[model samples]
Target: MSKRKIHATDIFNLISLTDPQWDKHSRKFAFVQTTMHEEDNEYRSAVYIGDLEGKTIPFTTGKGRATSPRWSPDGSKLAFVSNRNEKSQIYVMPANGGEAEQVTFCKNGARGPVWSPCGTKILFSTSVEGVQDLQQDEEEKKKKKHPEPLVVEKMRYKSDAKGFLDEKNDHLALLDLKTKEISLLTDGDRDYGTPAWSPDGKSIAFVTNLEENPDVSLVSDVYVMDLETKEKKKITNSNGFYSALTFSPDGQYLGFLGHEKEFQSATLSRVWVTKLESGETHCLSENLDVEIGDVAIGDFHSGNVNPGLMWTEDSEGFYFLMSDQGGTGIYFGSLDGAMYPIHLPDEHVYAVSMLTGTHEAIVGVSNSTDPGELYHFDLKSQTRNQLTNVNESWKNEVELCKAEPIQFKAKDGWELHGWIMKPAGFEEGKKYPTILEVHGGPHAMYANTYFHEFQTLTAQGFVVLFTNPRGSHGYGQHFVDAVRGDYGGKDYLDVMSAMDYALESFDFIDENKLGITGGSYGGFMTNWVVGHTNRFKAAVTQRSISNWLSFYGVSDIGYYFSEWEVQGNMEDKVEKLWEHSPIKYVSNIQTPLLILHGEKDYRCPVEQAEQLFIALKKQGKTTKLVRFPEANHELSRSGDLALRIHRLNHVKNWFVEYLQKA
Candidate 1:
């Protein structure tokens, strides 16, 4: 049988695999597998176990979603979070296969379960509203009365993902498995997360901001608490952002990933290790040019976990994920600030789990043609053995396009990296319309990964061109931070140069029928591009920013993001902000444009789209606006499956109408 070309709706048939974990004995792997449920309009997830021989089976079953699978120290049990009861809670089940047991019954719910070193207790996090712990029945009864008004006082009162925030704060709690008692460990008005237990189980390390006003501060300090005396000591100096806490096997050092806000959000994250006894800290990746965490952006995978700083058994060195050039790879870093590559293949390593004492690991990887899967990798030999074929059937039935790596120089002779995907079933002598796709995070990299939208466009007879501009990661700190104060300056030249390079290098691209699209930061760039140039025939901007003056107060991160990114704010630099806005040059836009946005989007906000649409319409320009209800900023990635499909179709039809039709 012949294979069929991939389509936008084919996303429903594709499977996503993530968060692979190795058992204590390293005999089996537990990972999360998710698939689209068209009837329910949701994604169904379950935990599955597999061995080195490629034998895999479901560990958690039923309708509810399961994720964050972690094996106990003895390898006899597995702990995971599930929403089987309509509320997320921790559950435990035998590793060999048996019925799962519910462990927590908190009023608001719980998640992120971490087993103690002795395996006798489990540490989890839950949201606490106040000092009183209201009974579930009483809470439901009160909810049946009147709706309470939300009082907003802080700048961080709302978020794009969680929506409006309340007085509740995230706190840690301990569950005694033998006694069946739950005790709240930490409390207050501050939020706490990313907890790690010491080897002896006497101390707990967590991340939180203890500043007088945490709402305005972007600092996340690591603190250690002594369980016996309830004493706390801060590790970080409250200067930067820190996360992914891990203690060395020998309990001598603590490792984490962070940056000192040198370039604000565009700063490269580096690995740091602190001596526990002497309170000395050293950066292990300070001299390395690459960022020390996974910054590759993709729209297909869900529930992906980045296991940072997997320490070796001897505690002399550790393995971590780093973004360099155009890919995310595995690297080993020592305590003395030396780095070495363990595996630097041109593929995206989204998740990884190290087998404590050996040079072996289980990783979840994906490429341009494959969605994702798990593999057993050897550090010494750098060889990978297939462990699961979850997406094998889907891969065999569809024809996908492969991204060809392209490198070129910017207008100033600076090097740039990107990829170009030819249309599926391409012929040498034929011409094809090309679409320039921009990524959302000017700080995130466009790596070699399976992108559903790119494949769908190629299958529809359009070539796709995507590149890492100056602000993109994996290209060192100086390159990534170059676009901080200059949103449309040289960064604009870098992308324009990429399109120029593509037209000059490839003979099949039709320059007259060009189109462009992007979301978030990419969306902002797309708006900027169409305003400045009329070379493209069509354009689609998703969740994009149009006016910096309005964006400063409307966006969730705008109050600071505007200042950190564009180097202008509404208060003192109103003129500068308006000067850099796309609305300033709206009269120059001659291309037919389509605007797509989520009604509930707070990151870029729907008002941004509304403003741009009104400006273009007022000027008698050709444009259309389509908004997805109940969708947020993540509409293209983790939003409702139906809406995601609708969004893909809208983007495809807009370009087809302008470029392919007369």
Candidate 2:
């Protein structure tokens, strides 16, 4: 009898993947429960709400992928978005789980439903039929002899996905509860999203990226609008990217997240608070090295532009999350700006929503060892109570590795921070092959978080080392800003130092054999590392920047990011960009390099991989390029589940084929 080949589906089932949500009152919780079938294509899921007894009762599930569950103001109902009818639409259900009623019967779609404070209106942004309208309006204007809009030719006039988009815009809309009247908030050729409400329900706060010249140097600024008067006001004026806006409980102060034009990595977002009355602003978390990643930001590094900062009903202090010490955790910062930890310092906490009439917050807690779980943490008593157990069955079956935080001195004597994952079934004396994994943002950090890739690598008998180099976030602003115009310089040294430390400290790590891999910025680094040194036997670069010159013209934010990082525009510094291009050094690369890219990725398009591959192949260096069909830059994150598994498997195979004993 032949043994059945273990597939990614098998591994996925062996591990748990749950996305949980907390209610406004924290009395009930809703999360997606996934059950994979071994033989069938269909996957089953349910939206469940847990009661005080820790028992989760099923709420609704008939057809679609239901998620983003938000409780109504009174907690009598739950509003969620589902793709049941082949498209995503808002749906409401009773808290106890019964019949679900559909809302928002629109032609295009609806998403991100948030109920009003009075429980009367639900606010969400929908893509209107504006393109046709804009074209018609342009025709009418042309008939009336109006001037034509400027036709400035750019490299991205035709994108990889949109394919020749002359006019592009995203608007905001609101749905009235009783009348069911939909009102368009702002009509313009720009992108506006992340709508938030004020405490008194008098106004709405949102972020808008005004399309200036199509250079992708978008101005994402915070704006405010009076709900009754329809008066709009731009609150932030600096040349910085501002997002994640929220109002204080008393409605006197507004908080937002922003980063200057120089630091465009999305990994150095700093918290800014503005007094609504005086219009004066102060940087609250300026010194902390953290990136605010969001779904709107597309799961990059959404720190809390507006973290769980529920102001005390009295508005004395606000809650926020700081990801500095090790992991992302919720903390309480006073109105005077003094900050302190709310939960125990040992655990990593996030997604904190306040429970009314209590000194506690319902937060999401996980650790280097455990997957995420909702915990009710009391600031007054300093006690944590677990609320939901989404993955009870996989609790013991899961192989959670210990992330031993390590600090080493760079060759320049600057101290650097990193974390190492020992091989699964690790013994202090046994030798194991190692994989040096680098994070993408170059601005991002590999903190003490539970990552599937790290754990799976450990499970396969590999020690993994990931570090926060000089360019990585969660240090200080200076450390993050230090990477500007210094790519492949000191930051590279920081990573090299981390690997050196890992090789020396871990007796179980085999120094003779090693593998290297990274995505995006990490990918660029991997390409650079392989070209610069032959220490690693194998390397995989995912969604990376190879030729900086091509990337400047090809990527969505390439024009802006190149200017920000390289500190030079495309026209001004062609030689400098080429010098920073990883492909330039491919002649020296001897390691077996595997390049993974997405076909429709506009951010770091397939051309990047092509440039590196052609360079290496011409030089007789071993190389392979795997392109995922119909995938975007976020292949590892929001790509199809099966595709993500395929990507991981391919990476594992590439590494094992080159590094593992033959």
Candidate 3:
């Protein structure tokens, strides 16, 4: 660890290795554990059991990664995936933990290993195998493939880098452990993802996007195939994306995540269970309105995503987490659609997944003053048992800030949730300048988890206040939908209301010195807030959206997202897009502004920053532009350590210069 102060940014490859598959039945016991070591950019495997504790397994090669270690039903072998050879391929190892054997040899790569009920076959996905099989003998057969004299195309989707494009798709496949035969499961002009095996092992259920006009990024419906006859059938027929599937012990009903294409003008996802035989589906949870907060969900959440369904063994119901009570606590919900809070005994939980054969769950936790710790949560006793203490090195070297939960009523007579962190060296009765930090994703929420940027701001002698406004997740669906097609409207009022409530209730905040900053949606709000009011002495917008029109064509997901966000596309609602754009109201901005952007960002694109920089410069307004090379939209959350530090330092320097009292 470097001398730099520990913040969330300093941590690398933070992940959970819950209930690693153990082969204790064998004399030479072996278990697989997952770890995030910077030495390897991605997660790698380590075998632990008996004397060979926490040893890196050599079954994988290169810097590419492997994870989600699972044992065959009988514990005779281990199955996992590795990208060491440039493509993720399945590999199996003996329970004694000797040399591993390569099991999958598909050209497109295999993923999501599910052992057959009897452990004789493994099901996975192969990218080009499906499409290749369907292209006909002359078209797909490399030897017989015909070449067409195609004309050169004009420049399209070209920018600073990644000049052109090509056709890409992924499909599902299955492998026979006995004969080592690989068979294509789903084929044709679409993509298939997230394959899960039924409990009986007679059928394999996988999701596929089979629509002729398919949205490339959207998910697919659940489809099943008979193992004996190779006969296939569709389980659910719905337009929305469906994934992250699991068999509810009995296999009578299949649980999966159902994502609506459009909800409040944004992607709406939740847990749903589809009865296999009846073809009936039921929404598992109330809309909750907030996006899933657990870290294990990655970009997908709901049914069996992360902290995957901790079955009760009786199969009455399984437990999964959702963003609730303003994204602060992880609550447990069941298929019955009832929810209850799981107290981690003062620990801030980011993820909760069950360890197989254990009543206790492996949880990812971190608090305002504590680095992340993986602990075990006992269900029956409601007691949390401490597991691995990984952040020991920083116990003495880092300064951690404690966040105090604060709640105040917004002007609309409804209670709003927020948290405040005092400066590290705070002096009693002394007023300090404050920074009102806003979270982006107007649809996203700021949870009570560990945040380095907020802690760093407090260390720099600034009080930090952040909250979940109307459109933030963790709140119910109504609260999340409150900001639909209404940018800078009620959401802006809610933020200002939070600041007003803070000033009136907290006497330690300096009234004359206030600063604000955020990235993405937060950036959009920062731009909108400063333009709408000069209350903030300084403002910084990172990877923000200033002009809506320019963003529609430039950003990668702009076309679909803009239409969803603004409720209309450029072709249909030009006036509404411009009306809500921050740049349109630039003349009203008086506060000094700092614009930060990443060069290779395709989500928000660098040109969005360029437009703001040029417009502000033309107006001779106090402004500065900072760009990160080779960085993308997630520069702050998942960017390189050096770049993340520089970004943090830049924000602190900008605020200190403008808000610090002389």
Candidate achieving the largest TM-score: 1
Per-residue alpha-carbon lDDT of model 3 for 1-662, expressed as tens digits?
Answer: 53344443444523333323334344222323444455534445544432113232333344545655666878777787777666677888775567777787665567667788798888776667343542234333356646765343422233322322234456666778889988777666566777778888888777776655554344467777787787878776656777667787788777776666657334546777777888788876654553444421111011123534445555656666556654434555566776566652443466555543445555656666654554556676877656555455565566566778788877777678888888876789999998988887776666656677887788788899888788776666677777878888888888999899889989999988999988898899999999999989999999999988988888766766777777657776998889889999998988999999998888788898998889889999999999999888777765555677688889999998999943
TM-scores, all models, native as reference:
0.98, 0.89, 0.84
Reference-based TM-score, model 2 = 0.89
Over 407-437, each residue of candidate 1 has an lDDT whose tens digit, in order, gives 9999999999999999989999999999999
Tens digits of per-residue lDDT for model 2, 156-252: 5655445345655456667777877767777776667888888788889888855465355557778888988888877876467776677787789
Best by lDDT: 1
Candidate 3, pairs of clashing residues = 289-477, 290-473, 290-474, 307-353, 440-522
TM-score of candidate 1 relative to the true fold: 0.98
Q: Report lDDT (CA) for all predictions.
A: 0.90, 0.71, 0.68
Off by over 4 Å in 2: 1-11, 14-26, 32-46, 131-168, 210-217, 262-267, 287-308, 344-347
Better of 1 and 3 by lDDT: 1
Ranking by lDDT: 1, 2, 3
lDDT of 1: 0.90
Please state every model's RMSD to the true fold in angstroms: 1.3, 5.2, 5.4
